[model samples]
Target chain A: MLNPTITEILLSLMQVSYITLIVLVVSAICGLILGTILTIIVVKKIPVLKQITVTFSSFTRSVPIIIQLFIVFYALPPVIESMGFSTTYITATVASIVALSLYHGGYLVEVFRAAYRALDKGQHEAADSMGYTPIQKFRRITLPQTIPVALPGWGNALIHLIHDTSLVFALGVVDIMGRGQLIAASSYGMNQVKIFLIIAAIYIVLTFLSDAIIRFFEKKNKKFKLDSGLNTKGA
Target chain B: MNFLILFEDFVQLLAVVPQTLLLAITIFILSILIGTVMALIQEYNVPVLKLIVVIVKLLLRGTPLIVLIFLMYYSLPDTVTFLSGLVGLDYNGTNIPPAIILIVAVSFTVASFQAETIRGSFLSINKGQIEAAQSLGYTPYQMFKKIIAPQALVEAIPEFSSSFLIVMKAISLGFMITVVDIFAEARLIATDNSYYVEAFFAAALMYWAISAITVTLSSKYEEYLHSRM
Candidate 1:
């Protein structure tokens, strides 16, 4: 087998970026929904549901991503098949997304919880006095305050999610890392170093790019001035 | 779903717990040592060293652990050969074990994160306390031992254990480079019986247990530090 050309590597990286974008967007949305539900359960202290969410969160937090990926990849099919769904569509990419979304959701639970708890109770009471509905209170009061506080943690999680995408290649998703492995292996490992270096450079670029975007939001969050006197009395 | 197979896989995975622990602990200690030196370099503004440390840390932060492991595994031999040739010495890099390479790579990656933790804790020391210690004619060592070390250790413990958990997770990547740590052992068992799910769950359980223990211990130590103060 011949060593891959630069164009081949670039094309592979393009494919990687595409998959990464899908994973990030889908997982972020899923994670937000999961995190909100878990946060609600925990905040309300909903008996069995709270315990189950807590245990699930801990499990996601502790298990290595690779193992989690494998478990999901191998286990989801059987479960889905038993539910009368075809297991044929449960590809490596799908399993990776599921696993990563769960990990993201688990982490966001803490971020949401902390940000939610940091919110001043007076704001809720004030919203209540105004005869605001629950949705109105959440939209007008809860979100604005918690988001600024949560932005930093959320951004950190985003960066981690980007890093976690690199692991998806282990599940044979043909992402950048997987492509690099194939390129090297096809050439009898003669180009392993070069391929690995290229892969690393790609990952670094992705991480820094996301980090800069996160920082921009973080800077914009400063305008809220939520960290000032308003929230101080609550703590 | 098969409880018996899961139990058997769990036992098999547990047998390799020592290997995983040894790797995790060694990497943790080595990284801490390297990270402290890097932190000290930055803390004291040690001229050119600070720039190099910063660059290394940035690179480490950006790159994934598996990439680092692969890069080191592939490049170290050539690097060793080149250095030996330059030094007029006979050395072969192929003789080095995969475990050593994994340790070195993971240590560097973990060290970058640890350096930040150490430096943050170091900076958390109050300037007034240092000034007071100085006025008392205490030596730097005395100031560190009497005042700085305790406070910094307390501040650093929580972050350090988080890094420890990271180290634990990172060693799982060792399976890629043929290091038969717990995760690797699990994969072997799964391949043998096609019980990948059970094998992975067992591995996950061990990882979860280790993390729980680390978190509990660190929090206890933090409490002890608080009580002492």
Candidate 2:
């Protein structure tokens, strides 16, 4: 058996990047929506909703991602079937996305909550005194300020999401890691080291690229802070 | 869901808790030792070694723990064989236990994060205090013992505990390499009974309970440190 060619490796990595990008975007959006709702429930101390949100977050955080993936993969089909829906369409990738999105939301709750709480009480009071409605206040005063503060944490969460997506291969998703497994198995386990090394290098490069992108946004957010005079005021 | 099977699965999973905890503790100790060395190298700006440490940390941080485990699983045997051959030990790589590979690989991954945590704690120490200690004619060891170690340890406790949780969690990946920890046992039980949800939930509950206990104990320890100060 021969080693996999460079093109095969690159092609597999490209597929990995593509799948990871999709998971990242979809999960990040879902997580943000879930996180924002949970933050509201917790911050406003909404009765039952707050308890459920807290419990759910803790559950997600405690379990390993792989276990969560397995749970979702196995449990979701039965759930949908019980609801009188077809379960055939729920692929490993879909389950992976659902589990990972929940995981991301679980973590982002704390991030957003911390960022939201870190906002000055004066800002809220000032908005109220200005006769601004709640929506108007949130959109104008709360969002812009909270975003710059949350940007760093959000970036860190995104990096984590990238890493977590690698576990999807365990569910038989043909991501780079899965592709490496296939290649190694095809070669009768020859060149297993080389295949894994290439995969690891690809992951490192992906992380480096994402880190640079995150830093870029962080810098941009810093400028937004300066323009809004948040720095001078030290809020 | 069959409640009886779930209860049985939970009991079966519980049997492997000691193995999981042992792996976690060993990995935590090894990683802390390795990470501190990396942190000290970076802290003191050890010339060429610092650069290597930084690069290795970057690589480790970017790569997922699962990938590291797989990489080690595949590569370590050959590397071990080559090294032993050079030393004329006539050892076979196949003799290495998968748990050892799991420990080494996971330690490298966890240690990178630990190194950053420790280095940050070291930097958190006030420069003024160090200057005061120096001007007071304190030796290096004295400065570390009297001025730096206590403060840095306190600062590091929160991050250290979180890293410990991470170490605990990472041990679950050991199942992928055939380590018969809680996760592996859970997987076996699930396969036997086809009750995936119950098996995983039991494992998750065990993990959560352990994490909660760790968190409480660490916080208590932190409080004790504070009270002594």
Report RMSD (Å) for each prediction in the order shown: 2.2, 2.1
Candidate 1 collision pairs: none
RMSD of 1: 2.2
Over the stretch A1-235, how does candidate 1's per-residue lDDT look in tens digits? 4877776766766776777678777887888788889988998899999999999999998998899889999999999999999988899989999999899999998998898888877888889999999989889888778877888788878878877888888888977787788878778888788788888888789789878987888788666646423455443
TM-score to native of every candidate shown: 0.95, 0.95
| Residues A14-90 of candidate 2: C-alpha lDDT, one tens digit per residue | 76677767876898789888888888899899999999999889888777888888889888999999999998899
DockQ of each: 0.83, 0.77
Least accurate 10 contiguous residues by lDDT in model 1 chain A: A226-235
Model 1 Cα shift for residue B45 (angstroms): 1.7
Across B126-149, the per-residue lDDT of candidate 2 in tens digits comes to 999999999999999999889998
TM per candidate, chain B? 0.95, 0.94
Q: What is the lDDT of residue B104 in candidate 1?
A: 97
Q: What is the DockQ of candidate 2?
A: 0.77
Model 1: how far residue A63 lies from native, Å: 0.6
